[model samples]
Target chain A: MSSTLQSRWWSWGFRSAVMLYFILLIVFPILGIYGYSLSAGLAAFTENITEPLAWKAVLLTVKLAFVSTMINVLIGTMAGWVLIRYRFPGRGLLNSLVDLPFALPTAVAGLMILLLLGPQSVVGQWAEQLGFSILFHQPAIVIAMVFVTFPFVIRAVQPLLEEMDGSEEEAAYTMGATKAKTFVRVILPAMLPGIASGAMLAFSRALAEFGAVVLVAGNIPGKTLIASVYIFGEIESDNITGATAVSVVLLTFSLLILWLVNYLQSRRKGV
Target chain B: MHVEVRGLTKKFGEFPAVNDVHFSIAKGQLIGLLGPSGGGKTSILRMLAGLETPDSGDIVFHGTRVNDLPPQEREIGFVFQNYALFKHMTVQGNIAFGLEVKKWPKNRIKERVAELIELTGLSGFEKRYPHQLSGGQRQRVAFARALAPEPQLLLLDEPFAAIDAKIRQELRAWLREMIDRLGITSIFVTHDQDEAIEVADEIMIINKGNLEQKGSPWDIYKNPETPFVAGFIGESTIVEDVSTLRGFEQAADWPGTKALIRPEYVEIGQANEFRLLSATETGRVRHLHFRGSEWLVEVDVGASRLVTYRSLEKEVLHPGEEIQVLVHRAYLFNDNDSWIMENRLKEDPMPVHI
Candidate 1:
């Protein structure tokens, strides 16, 4: 009876410690950002965010995040499907390479993209000849965002694809469904939850991306400047309130999306 | 449809999974491929369904060679061992999937799904998803889904393998009845001899990627064409060195031959009452087990032990008791492991009637 009581106390102590750690690390910081954002009142907060440059930065970040996440979901899912299903030489090597973005420093990824497409590489030169610039442009920003966010969808979907039995698709084929139809009906439906969650992570990651997008986007105010880079500019100009306001907005949006994903998954479980 | 597999073979990497397997099934005949695991039964079934391409030989359906045909073109219905029902779809939706894929009219698809749901006894589970259904219900949905497409041949890979023990038996009878009612040629692969014998009209024995024998369950049980079949199908004592067998030395020389003696065929009697049996030899009872309806008594026949059954008579047979075991009948296999003869009454002059 004493030993059981001791274990119960230990469990409670561990739970409280974890809750306290999360409260101090995450919840307190978020509350601090909100408090600073509203220090000068809601009118000052609105005026700070209503600046044309900052508002355009927000719009540009949203567009980049959306487009990049859409591309990531399509390409990453296909890559994951091939990696899990097909047997080819170097498949293990290719599967391992999908995590390169996660392992590499985001700034280094940005530099690598710069080296490959920044008016010097062969493809970059060919694009220059075609009268289209890829470096320090919208495409480069999107590309950098995609590079950093590539692994999220693939990592999420790969495990799911591996866990699913191939017999279901085989059954579909024997039942007279074409290969394309089988993929669309049987395989895709099973992969949706993974795809949706992965896309959300990629969107959030792209939304908050700083190092890679700043290097490639050139941070042209009201043009290629994104929300994070705009906040960085605000911090550089000694405007902590402006930066904190934008930070609270991004934080709240990220929290909302995460909560929405969790809600959707729980709703599916309820069904 | 009448299905024929001619010299079909499949190899995985360097190992052959199904080697030169050949068989033909008449139209509307329900056949069972009975074998142990890794015995090529599933490979053969997949080959027939065009799910797995054979390395060599041809698969013909109703006189048309379908060796190069893809699974979708072959129009085969396959029920996976795990059911493989679409988890996201309702039972009705799962059944209608195949019809919808084939571009059947919406109303026709619904009508066909309803018919199949009723046929598979899943009328109340039409709206339930695969996860909501029980194992047996999932199996029925798989069957209904496979059948909804109206394929030429239906193949089931261990249809009753995943259900509970009691439900396994019930589903076996239900599946057999459903197949018979549909009048569609179907073949199911199973590792259980009892399941195959009880459910299939004809049983095909496969071992180590080789087709050992194919016949009715009764014929395979009684007159097994191979020593493997004899040992596999039913309970029997196999004596490889037949020369060591008591009262069989004077028989004709069958080099490398083995003899199979079924338990029920060996009649046991008391040592003093040898006259009650024909062609009798003396042996002591090594062990005795009361099997409720009968006694499974093991007799030490000199070099080896022979297991034989005895009725639960008034005199219960006990261990270490002297008894006379009559070899009423036995099967003999040749050197190449093929059935040579069925040694019946008055067969050899080796042992005399006591």
Candidate 2:
């Protein structure tokens, strides 16, 4: 090639290399799984996708994700509210503690949850006596998921809470809003987008969490087996097709969640 | 409403943002809580608004102690330094927010919001969001929002600080007229002395968390009670020695306390043989400066202090030329009251930081 053409070719070559790396790292595996899911054509798609066990896994995952997301949104809003707007003795320590989930590995987090609610810890014993089976149950999956995804909602919402002009709440108060009413009317509407976006992020993260869920959920087939654990089991049993099918369902759901969150974010930005 | 603050002190960490400040604001007066930056004007405003509580002392509104009441229960209006417009809300919605919080009737809110938009001259801008308006327009929106609900007391924290200076002067005058029309008791906090003078019925000049002086603008300018007030309110130099000019016009009547003079009152060529120990050159072409309708010319004495003179006509003088100067309006005060002296017969020789 001529020198000018050589430079053009080199730039094109670099672009191809980067594209190939993405394909190898992410897109290739996804494509492989998608192909495997569709290998049996319409028959395999119908059979694997709508299997009773597979349906249970999807249902359980959705229920856990939904409940965890709601709880996280509520508690995370309060947590973020405190972290940004209040000055307590351990304010700095509490601020750092919010980032614990991200800093702690999911496996370690799962173990900590297990230890706390595994019928051995004080809380776990009390919980069992109170007629709640926290560990080795569907609630165990939820507890594990909430633990891994707690900070997502708090971290996402806290900055937005901090960015808000505190004067609005004060204005509400000066105009005769009680503390609760001020938060409900003036503060909540403004914080809704952040909370919504954060909850969605947490939901997606919860759906993908495996290490924590596997430890807490004892992998009982019809009772405690979650989507991630289901995928692990299929892979271990050499049923790559089943693993790919389960993953495809999760991938689609997470994408839908993120898209909804992106819509909320865009609306907030437009404000 | 008449408001009295006694021994109001606010400490942020260890630094006292507002010291033991005591000032009673008369009802229906548009007063300015004037101070420089870090002088605790805003802190005092916040405390009065019930957004901040004093570590000691109490605030009494009318006859009732209000420190224990929440801000909403205080029935007071606060306009923040930048106007604090809700960016998400349109002009109409922003104005209506306060009334909505009060849970005012729908019809009343609509009528009130409309009236406010009209009063603030934002008639066609009701649909615009805060970000869509100019700085002055946002200011008007904030004003409209604060006044839409009939508050017993209105507190403005540096309301015009964000606007351009030209707009600020016009707005300051307009604000005074508006507040007077409502006959509302308003305490506006500002660091600009000129803004306070131009806008307030009475101004409370504060410094370093203490109320230095409180009086009408004329009184403050004509007779500043303290050195801080005198220095902050007007443009005049404190000379090292102005002893003989002590009672001034009352010189033969009763020799009052220590001496002082206004720069404008010190007339050049008004008298002769008034002690020319410090004499300097003044030429018709050298020493004149235009001061609006007047010219302020300087005649330097041997001691390096330029006694300033004012005249409507441009009386120019060249440098190194002869000119006679005299003191017409001079202030006499007790030595103990003054933070510093221009001259002294039995002066204590104290250090003064300008």
Per-residue lDDT for B1-354 in model 1, tens only?
999888988899999899898899999999999999999999999988888889998999999999888898897899999988888889988999889889999999989998998898998889888888899999999999999999878999999888899999899899889999999999999999999999999999999999999999999997788788988988889776655654465345767777778897677887665553445778899998889898988998877788988888647877888877776666777656555343343355566779
Clashes of 2: 14
Which candidate number has the best lDDT?
1
- Candidate 1 runs further than 4 Å off: A267-271, B241-249, B271-278, B290-293, B312-314, B337-354
lDDT of each: 0.87, 0.80
User: How closely does chain A match the true chain A in each prediction, as TM-score?
Assistant: 0.96, 0.89
For the record, the alpha-carbon RMSD of candidate 2 to the native fold, in angstroms, is 6.7
The 10-residue segment of model 2 chain A with minimum total lDDT is A168-177
Give all TM-scores, in the order shown.
Answer: 0.93, 0.84
Per-residue alpha-carbon lDDT of model 2 for A1-271, expressed as tens digits?
5999999999999999999999899888777877878887868777876887777887888888889989899899999988888888999998898888888888998888888887888888888889987889888888888888999888888877877868877776777778888777778877888888999999999888899888889988867788888988888999877878889899888879989998988977776
Evaluate residue A236 in candidate 1 and report its C-alpha lDDT on the 0 to 100 scale. Answer: 98
Q: Who wins the DockQ comparison?
A: 1
